[model samples]
Target: MNDNDVVRDLTLDGNAVAGLLEEVFGADMTTADGECAHCGSANAVGALRAYTRAPGVVLRCPACGGVIARIVQTPRGTLVDLRGAAHLAMRR
Candidate 1:
């Protein structure tokens, strides 16, 4: 298997997390603009590839496959790690 195959097998479009994002962000954020910190790739939050088989949701840049964000739900609360994202512009 190749990188593309692996990626395909492990990921889904960011839309899969629409409800989770709305819950975390307090609004529909699927159409939000996002910039990847790792590769400088820009795309809609909904356009990013999402890997949900982990303990949390891992969103990645589709162009470069760099992680853009990670959202985890813990008993304490939700943990949003955006270290992989340079910017996220959500519409009002």
Candidate 2:
């Protein structure tokens, strides 16, 4: 399948989204203010606002304004990638 097809067909539930957020942020999905394990910054709020607005959307760090992470949900579980943040340069 083409990239467009894959993007159009991806589906995720709330539970999966929550799991992804937890895995990435190490806190509840709705709360904010978690430590960014990468940069050691106190501004890692889980970015729940960004997540809820766009369920599978990844967000950049508001403090550093860098692409520090992503969130994805699948049948297996939620996936978070802190290493994606270009500025942090740290892994979870």
Q: Give per-residue CA lDDT, model 2, range 12-83, as digits (tens).
A: 323445555567656564344445444555543444224334656655454444545566777787777767
- The pairs that clash in candidate 1 are none
Q: Could you say which candidate leads in lDDT?
A: 1
Judge candidate 1 against the unseen true structure and give its global Cα lDDT, from 0 to 1: 0.91
**Residue clash pairs of candidate 2:** 33-45, 67-85, 68-85
Per-residue lDDT tens digits for candidate 1, residues 1-92, read 99989868987988999999999989988999999998887899999999999899999999998888899998999999999999999887
The list of candidate 2 runs beyond 4 A from truth reads 1-41, 46-55, 84-92
**Candidate 2 lDDT score relative to the true structure:** 0.49
lDDT of each: 0.91, 0.49
